[model samples]
Target: MNAFRTTRWSLIAAARDSPSRAQAALDQLCQAYRPPVLAFIRHSGYGNDAEDLTQAFFLRFIERGWYAEADPQRGSFRALMLTALRRFLSDQYERAGALKRGGRTVESGSLLEVIASDGQSPEDAFMRAWMGTVLEHAMQRLEEEWSSAGKLDQFRQLAPLLLERAEGDELRAIAVANGLRTNTLAVQTHRMRQRLRQLVRLELLQTVGSPEALERELAELRGALDEMT
Candidate 1:
């Protein structure tokens, strides 16, 4: 069937599985969601410890049967994940003096590290963490849609545009370089924006049970973005 339809079904199937199946589903979901979560953690002041903490959180989440407590009727997955991360951070901070550092550090690191090392505040770090999570969720859904539709390469080609803001001249230059007319590039940009919005909505839907939840999430995302600026 269609990729969009498949994504919808996959989400439902994943949510309704038996224990073993649920674990598999959660694994896939985590794979899709982990990068942004890691970025968020790193931005939230965890630094080199982010990856290890993120992994530990997931391990404990599963071992503690956390997924079984997921209440789709109450909140979006993003919110729940953020809440989990917040609790993890609080606990880690309280035990910071006692906890021994372990695990391989992320070599390439995240954008948050660059921002923090530049002397950004903890509030900035918090907002960046949220922004990274939202962006990651949006990108993951977009990638999944593209992969399912067999247009993964096309999406990859447009990845830069997806990640950053584009000026009109810059977009025109890219269009010309790619052998496309400016008007065509404009349309493509519009489509990309729409897809991004849709991806965000799809993610919100997974955590939220209704349109109102999506609205709330969009507002939160916007607020976080504003904080970064």
Candidate 2:
């Protein structure tokens, strides 16, 4: 019922409606999440090849319609992405001499350098991966909640317009579309905003191991979104 949960559910519902759009949304989500994923891959000790492989895994997720298989009832999006990443790494390890090699010449810098820029240890890298997994799960929960409530369709139609227009214009449009009075629409919008915040907090609760961890994780989530902007 928090903002994060609402956003997460909205996205899941959107994804369920259209795979292409879902992928686009997922790509946007990944931009916030990729650094941690990359750090995990690097800490696991794969070379730059592994980094490229990690990027390719995301690309494949879209190209193959991977999100279509995501089931919020079964598990979280965070678990799914990390599971896929682990599988990809496992398959790559099976390739000839993949694990035996030292640093082979890569186009970009070493994966380790990318992951350990601030003297980060392998444990730090692992924590990053854990965080990414947690956030992804939170997103999935939000999506499921919205889809169940059947407001996802309305949200999708109005989100872009509302984001662009002034409050009066947005209220007018929403009121007309939903067959509500302007005052009623305004109240609905306020409720919707409240729901979004609640959803976000719910998601944050699931991701962080404890209440003390929530503040830091929330800050990181905000920072990740800011980076996208």
Q: Tens-digit lDDT track for model 1 on 71-141? A: 65576666666677777667766555343344434344421344446565544554565556656878977
Give the per-residue Cα lDDT of candidate 2 at 216. 64
What total of clashing residue pairs does each candidate reach? Answer: 4, 19
Question: How close to the true structure is residue 104 of candidate 2, measured as C-alpha lDDT?
Answer: 50
Candidate 2 residues lying further than 4 Å off, grouped into runs, are 1-19, 96-124, 129-229
* Candidate 1 stretches greater than 4 Å from native: 1-17, 40-48, 93-130, 136-173, 177-179
Q: Can you list the residue pairs that collide in candidate 1?
A: 75-207, 76-207, 76-208, 77-207
Please write out the lDDT profile of model 2 over residues 119-161, one tens digit for every residue: 5554356455655555455445545666798978766654444
List lDDT for all candidates, in order.
0.65, 0.59
What is the TM-score (0 to 1) of candidate 2?
A: 0.43
Per-residue lDDT of 158 in model 2? 49
